[model samples]
Target chain A: EAGVAQSPRYKIIEKRQSVAFWCNPISGHATLYWYQQILGQGPKLLIQFQNNGVVDDSQLPKDRFSAERLKGVDSTLKIQPAKLEDSAVYLCASELSGANVLTFGAGSRLTVL
Target chain B: AQSVAQPEDQVNVAEGNPLTVKCTYSVSGNPYLFWYVQYPNRGLQFLLKYITGDNLVKGSYGFEAEFNKSQTSFHLKKPSALVSDSALYFCAVRAAPGGRRALTFGSGTRLQVQP
Candidate 1:
């Protein structure tokens, strides 16, 4: 019963540069999600995936942010040409069932200069 | 249109004393409410949830939340606070049973427990 896994506990990027974060949800979990948590703010949903297909990504910045869960297992969230405001923590979560509480990863902290 | 609000940005309490963190929400139909605790540099951990049945739902770490339908509020509570209870608390909500899967979270309330 391992928890959701995420990589690169911390990252630093310059404005206009690109950065990517990865996530591995718990085994047997059917849903995966990516959320952005800015300092002093709640985590905002960026994208959600049910299996290998996307369930919702309406809040995602299409022009700069993109995410995908290939084969319905691993996920990657990318931000192209990052902005200073993009400095925040990226969290990955998994849900065994939509009716249950989510299990979250440690998160990847991004500091954009 | 589901949303949660944590009016207080921070709350302070002394060890061995009771503690309460307030939260309110708005959503259509039945609401699935939840409380989560986040330690610094870590992700959120589920504390409790209110789906149905009892209005007072207990959760991990000696935490509990009372769900009031009329008030549309789910406030976290602990009978006796501990210094380890200090952390960031978030209130979240979503439509229960056959609704959006995404959770709407509050800005969060920082709990500081003084020993």
Candidate 2:
């Protein structure tokens, strides 16, 4: 069984520039999530998708961040006009419906200079 | 609203010694709690979860957590520590009743087991 897969393990961008991170969850997983982990902090859920339909995005900054799951399999998180504080690791996790176990990806670390 | 707290920023223990990492949570009604460990430059690995029935739950890597409803705490423990066990540990809780399934996590605690 393969774990969740994420791409571009590392990224560096300038402030105000736009950046995007990609995530491909485990096959057959019904729930996908995007999280932001700042240094010394636990990952915070940025958004969640249940089969291509957003389940939660209350913490997402609408003005600068957006995410979507295509066909409920792969997902992408984008940040436009990035801020220095946005520098963090973007983690992707997936779980089956009604299951509590969550499988995570290695994450993409973003450095905004 | 749901939240978890790891009061300690770091915990140190010698190899072969018993270890404990503290965690507390705040949520309305029943709480679904979890523990995850992250090694350097690695994604979080699920350690264990407490949904119902048992206050003591054992998980991967010889880890266990005891859910104390009265104290609203779930502390991770291991009988014998190993150098390889050094990592960042996070505690998380599911959202409130009828809310999204997204988890709210603690700031994280770094555990260092010395050899």
- Chain A TM-score by candidate, in order: 0.97, 0.97
> What are the runs in model 2 whose C-alpha is more than 4 Å off?
B95-100
Sort candidate 1 into its docking category.
medium
Candidate 1: lDDT of A107?
Answer: 98
* Model 1 error, position B63 (Å): 0.9
List, for all models, the DockQ compared with the true complex.
0.67, 0.69
Give candidate 1 regions above 4 Å deviation: B98-100
lDDT of 2 by residue, A34-102 (tens): 999999888999999999999889999999999999798999999999999999999999998777878
Cand. 2 Cα-lDDT = 0.92
Tens digit of lDDT per residue, candidate 1, span B1-115? 8889999999999999999999999998999999999998788999889989999999998999999999999999999999999999999998878334788899999999999
Candidate 2 local lDDT, B1-115, one digit each (tens): 7889999999999999999999999987899999999999999999999988889999999999999999999999999999999999999998434235788899999999999
| Residue A52 Cα positional deviation in candidate 2, in Å, after optimal superposition | 0.8
Q: What is candidate 2's CA lDDT for residue A98?
A: 76
